[model samples]
Target: MNLPELLYALALQHVPNLGDSTARKLIRHCGSAEAVFREKKQNLLKLNGIGKTRIANLQHTAHLKAAEEELKFIEKNGIGVAYFRDQDYPEKLKHCFDGPLLLFYRGNINLQKKKLISIVGTRNITGHGAAFCEELIAGLAPLDPVIVSGFAYGVDITAQRAAVKHGLQTVGCLAHGLNQIYPKAHRKYMAGIEENGGFFTDFWSTDKFDRNNFLKRNRIIAGLSEATIVIESAEKGGSLVTADLANSYNREVFAVPGRPGDIYSKGCNDLIKSQNAHVLTSAADLVYILNWELPSTERAVQKQLFVSLEPEEEIIAEYLQNMGKAELDLIALNCKYPTFKAASVLLNMELKGLIRPLPGKLFELV
Candidate 1:
């Protein structure tokens, strides 16, 4: 974007108490960020959710001055900015209701790859958790998925380092502004991370470093990926919050189950018991659930000759044969079965080699 337009957008973003969702609504209503400033207060209040308090600072000159200063910092630092409305914004994040209005990134990061997986866990990662995290990334290396995580001490660093070791691109979402790195010890790894994939953040250069910022940063980690995996977490942590955010965004969430009574495993077990996340034992589980490509031998579609199916399975098979592919809900509706029952029948059919599961909860005849 040009200087004038970007400045206006940044000013809109800087408006106090105005969030991304509300900002987007105003921008859409006004047609442009520049237009939002020029729009009359009476007109803006007409839109739902645009309360007096939210837009109270719309006319404040301080926001524009702050935007100009931020713009200068961005230019001087050679940072790349992705406007929410632009084509270059992360595609998956675009679907989120509360995604950032603008994303600032640095390094050789690329978003064209469709396979984005987020890995998050406790800062006090256990040995087993670290092993699983590394093994999972190593197993998934062949798919060339972009691994994403907060560049924190434990599980996050383990996953990102493994991704680098495996020659995969990895992105670090920062809770603070890109101008500074938290847990200063992590600074050493920044160069390697930027060499392949880089850092992403929405915080301005002047934003304060606060513990509360991590909660807001969690949303970006959850929003950027097709799935978020919790390697290990206590009963409560930022990683669990990220899992919840991913579920809220309708993205897949996976948790690695640990032994019973294990403090760190409690969170994962709870998530699975509540049916909020899928139990992830290995990378293969993620691959199958996401419908990523398998090895050629495993991917070969061999029809099971004279395959036998139960009555419900037969009904589903016929539906898929006619429809080519059908989602679980549709299969249940057309086959006169409850959704859970349909899922069970489909699982049997899959084991029988009569059908297969696909991404987006779709199923098809083998």
Candidate 2:
């Protein structure tokens, strides 16, 4: 089997306490990943912070049979591996201090785009919010831009699925290595992503999923993409972390607004209200602000032939638009769902980020 540079990069990756930054430093001083492997323990420990413990731990490179097994698993699946020192590593992400030393990609999507955006939100979403997500995805659909996100739940899935449905490349940035899909439910879909062109992660199969690894994964999501989009975040967690990192990297941050009282919407509205994000009401809003150059095919398909909404959906959308705002109960009556079912639908829509909820279950069409 033909192995890539990252196969060896995984050697350094398997070493404890020897991160990308330190690895890069070692490579800069010593030259090449192979040299680091060939060096004696005393020589490795001579470098700054290359403590005795780190060197001793790294000597375990001799036990690469496990790493080899990990590589075999991914290779068996025909997945691709990328390393920072290789020409295929993303140019934009290479400069980041703690960027990944290697990535395991399974999809056919384009990591390089004139503009890339990340979409993420809560696992629990609203139908109203989902509608908004659909609209946003539909609006942005024509642009042919690469969409990047963690392959978790809610907004992330929505954005990736929508992008693929619209014939755009979507890259799923994974927290764990390509060894397995975390949620497991999305395996079939993730396989479809690989078929259509979305890549996976960098770690070896044996690198059991870890919490800190997820945090490290976020930087790559932010670094690889050109901008970040928060569809529906609660006031805390992963989506917020992505937004913060994107801003730190000076990438554009866009947030859809939510209602005053809706818990899910609070994060997005707050980000905009706090000036961490530019407010985006529609794809048009984003296109205009960014002066985006839309793909020709997408522009041709922009006109809505029929209202994509169902009869009751149109009524609810119209009702929300006319009332300027109404609580979930009032909207529920309009949509034929019991309050509970209606709420579920609304959460899905909210994840899509369609309408913002107000203080008393009130929702206003965005």
Q: Which candidate has the top score in lDDT?
A: 1
Best candidate according to TM-score? 1
C-alpha positional error of residue 230 in candidate 1 after TM-score superposition, expressed in Å: 0.4
lDDT tens readout by residue for model 2, 74-185: 7688877767777778776786777777777876755554477778778787776677776676666656677788878788787778877887778888888666787788
**RMSD in order of candidates:** 10.0, 8.0
lDDT of 1 by residue, 1-366 (tens): 677878988998899889899898888999888999999999998999888887788988999999999999999999999999898899999999999999999999888955999999999999889877876886677678999999999999999999999889999999988899987999999999999999999999999999999999999999999999999989999999999999999999999898889999989999999999998866656877897764454345466667666687778888999999998889878999745456656654665557788988898987
lDDT of every predicted structure (CA atoms): 0.88, 0.72
Q: What would the TM-score be for candidate 2 when compared with the true structure?
A: 0.76
